[model samples]
Target chain A: MTLALRVEHLRKSYGAVAALDDVSFEVERGEVFALLGPNGAGKTTSIEILEGFIARDAGSVEVLGIDPGDRQHLRGLRDRIGVVLQELAVESFFTVRQVLERNAGFYPHPRDVEEVIDMVGLSEKSDAKVKRLSGGQQRRLDIGLGIVGNPELLFLDEPTTGLDPAARRTTWDLIRHLAAEGTTVLMSSHYMNEIEALAQRVAVLSHGRVAALGATATLGGRDRSEATIRFTLPSGVAASDLPITPWRVEGDTVEVRSDDELRALHALTSWALEGHIAVTGLSVARETLEDIYLALTRGDRAEIDEEPDDTKARTP
Target chain B: MSTDVRPAPQRSRFSDLRLVAHQVKYEQLAFWLNRVGAVFTVGFSVVFLVMLGASAGSQKVQSLGDISLVSYYVPGFIAYGVMAAGFTTLSVTLVVRRETGLLKRLRLSPVPTWVLISSILISTAIITLVQALLLVVIGRYGYHVAFPSSWLALLVAVIVGILGFAAMGVAISAVVPNQESAGPVTSIVFFVLLFLAGLWFPLPPNSGLAKFSNYLPVRHLIIAMDHAFGVPRGATPWAWHDLLVVALWGAGATLVSLRRFRWAPRRV
Candidate 1:
């Protein structure tokens, strides 16, 4: 696959706090890549560096095979890259249609402003002032601006951060459409479900570094074959004194993990039959992205990654 | 088996220019709607015209005693109109855009920086021209001011005044914190320059302050317009020195803005 953007050992800091440290990732052409992180995890900073708006202290970054900061390439490069900034700042006086029409002029071949407006479902509100639009409508306008240039590479930074479920779903459809048209997208989102629904691959960033990078299903090796089964026993049954040595019992629930689903099922049924214990509310589920994210980013793990040298010295 | 590859299509120069023009057009539309632009245009014209009428009645008038009271105020008011539309408008727009992040968005766009700045400059220049023509018509019909004796000199002064003011406006925006502060800062500086440069009223045409005014930029611009009205010429050395000072200020403003201008919100 052709690579659209690549970063090597990117580093950024504000005073003593590191915003991005030794971060590296490659996004292939025409792929939807998501950067997942909690707030203040340098997702925005990394994207800003790629957009040519900020310079990195230590990194060799390339977008569309050119250094974005080089002035000679800015016009051409900007035309090819669409960026949806976290905060959309449209002049309160300008209409939605006017804003789109104006931004279209910045490219050699921008998509038709009216068509883009219609696509984003802002046709009725086209003539209304931007400040008058609803939050979701404003987000739509921001997306409209990002796509109006017909950019080959698009950057979406939390495009659905404040949207309602219905609006977010609509936005997802739009993103899917863009990706289907072969536009390369690099998105940073805090919503893991959004990433899972749209991304071909994801890089989970914690503190200043990537903790896990892979397909959404497999980040932190989350998609495991074995499933965990748990069931609650009646009051007469002793939860901890189950026949199965490997199972964990707490409150009235007996929890078991096994690779062989049928064998585990057989063993649990026979054991319950012998004990004359009634099992209720049994559930078996696979590991999810949420579970993986929790495992990777929880508590001291982030602190360790945040200050690896301090962690190493203390451990020794 | 045969292989054939087509060359890539090249973008037309017209296409590029059209894009730039479109961006600039949007910018001009936004500036027009901004309250400051409207307030300055209307307020400057109304207030100055009234001041001219009031001053003409109360103050001693010389130079072409035959010239009507309306004609006497025309050149000065037109000068005021140009400064209002161009310099004041440009500075406020810059600071507001900075505070609002519009300038940062522009920096990220595909248009050349020169084209962006030039479009604004050109728009303000056009607005000034329109206002000047309107002021001249008003002077001719309402106040019965004679047509400028040297339209060429007035034109030169207007252009120079625009360049000096617009550049200074941009430079000032770089230092101002936000749009609200920008308004007061620009107003204070503008009034100071106007009074010292003799925009409010003429100093003695040959007095020491008038001689020193010849060295002040606003003074040179006003004098240049006043000179176009067949007003007596000032000390040649001082006038040239004033022109030089204004030109230097303009150049300095542009350089300072270029060096220090930022288009992004500071990292929080």
Candidate 2:
């Protein structure tokens, strides 16, 4: 309902490389917003600047209604914000409960340490040394640390990057639960499904610039984009006999792309009915979020942009 | 500037002090729970004292007066304990913490830098104090060596050494590039300093090793501990001049730490 954080013309440079160039976005008090970008796309840099961990070169940045750039106000702002970095920062020797309790002491109003343990699904491992926990469990404990303070705003930079499928699903549920409980969540991820599953709105960053910003489904007008309809041609049928000509045909398959998918589908099915032909392998699908993301970023490594299995690093 | 007066996490001074105590409790837990870290930080001094005491027996060091070799060994190992805890162990731990992103996490938390720093320093002081006490007990009971004549003087020297070495610890941690090299870098620097400071054997007052190490804090801390223990027999149990030199090195190291300290991981 209210602005939790706002940035205006945010700019930062690392020597010759501009890490963030005129970045601007606003996060509402209870919205789950996402910054979708690759490795060097300035997502982490933006999060760090907002967390008061680093200063912006030139920008009017405000977090929780306080200027993060002002040194005197940073502590109070930190009290209201939670950060989960890419690295699991829990010490190897301290037990889960011990680390949580220690960090809890830093905040004026800390959540119940036991409740945080349960919330992160680490109740059974509270007394276990951090080094003993599995990677997923450790990642859960790391999230537990972030929320132990009951912060108003949560910053999660690649929260589930190295997590397995089950762990990632649990993490997504936990993030949703937090956001539903009125915690403004700002997150960055390389996974499109993750953004689609969680974020209500997203800002796609590329080369340190906001290439696209809108609701997740409608990003880059993807919802309004033309849908592709594909159907394998019936044996001995001519492509020209159809009411609408195919956009492209490869071998026996016919591809049809149109903004009026309903009209096109009707025409193709009507022709099939008249010819007593079965329209097998027929499907109509909108532009996938990954496809739109790549298009918006100007094809910033399609391999890195979409596939999590490959394209390891993304250049700035 | 008016809006700068923000809501503090813990408003009262008493509560802020409690916050540091809270962090220190976990720090101690972290150190002691790790068997290897505890052994390396505190056990080393205990093991060294017992071994050296058994071998030195009744041998006398006639450098200034006939102080038995075991008595000299006690103060020397005690100083070594302080440096090991505050300098070597602290530096390596810090580098690992920084490289692992622990420091960045702490920086992002609501806790002030002062609280985080003081908690670690206090934790280091506690480790050193425990070692010093353990060594003193071993010397007094196991080897029949007399305790420091002035316990207050020894406490002052121990505190000074802790502060000085802790500063140098932060300074050295800043130079260490990564976690893999943290141990080797700190140990190599520490062992060389220890050798020059005469930990293996007491340096004769004006020996070349003594003259050279005089400019380093390790030797000054050793001399201060020696005076507190009255190693040369009936000497003043205060070494203000030596403590001053150690304090100066600490101040210089403090400047280096201020200039070079970074919270974020270097590789990132």
Highest-TM-score candidate:
2
C-alpha positional error of residue B265 in candidate 1 after TM-score superposition, expressed in Å: 2.7
TM-score for each predicted model, relative to the true structure: 0.82, 0.92
> Chain A in model 2: its TM-score?
0.91
Residue-level error in angstroms, candidate 2, position B120:
1.6
Model 1 stretches with alpha carbons more than 4 Å out: A12-18, A225-288, A298-316, B1-20, B51-58, B61-73, B191-198, B203-217, B231-239
Q: Give one digit per residue, the lDDT tens place, for model 2 in B1-268.
A: 0122224555788888998999898888878887767888678878888888888878898884998888988888889888888888888888888878888898888787788888988988888888888888988899888889889999999999999999999899888889899999899999999999898888888889889999889988988999999878888999999999999999999888877787877644
- Scored on chain A only, each candidate's TM-score is 0.88, 0.91
State the lDDT of candidate 1 residue by residue for A1-316, as single tens digits. 6789999999987668888889999988888999988777778778888988776778899998878757567566887888887766567788999888888867656899999999899989999999899888888888888889888889998999879999999899889988987888999997878999999999988888898889887777657656788877666756555554446777667778877767787877788788777768878877788888777777723332332111000000
Q: For candidate 2, give the DockQ.
A: 0.37
Per-model CA lDDT versus the true structure: 0.74, 0.86
For model 2, the stretches where C-alpha displacement exceeds 4 angstroms are A231-243, A249-254, A269-281, A299-316, B1-10
Instruction: For residues A82-178, write the lDDT of model 2, one tens digit per residue.
Output: 9899898889888889888888888898999999999999988889988999999999899998999888889999999899999999999999889
Per-residue lDDT tens digits for candidate 1, residues B1-268, read 1112223325677765665577667766876777668668756776677667756764445543434455546666667766776667777777777666577667777766767777877777777777778777766676656566767766776777778878878778777767778788888887887777765555656778777766656776666666666654231212344456777878998788776666664333
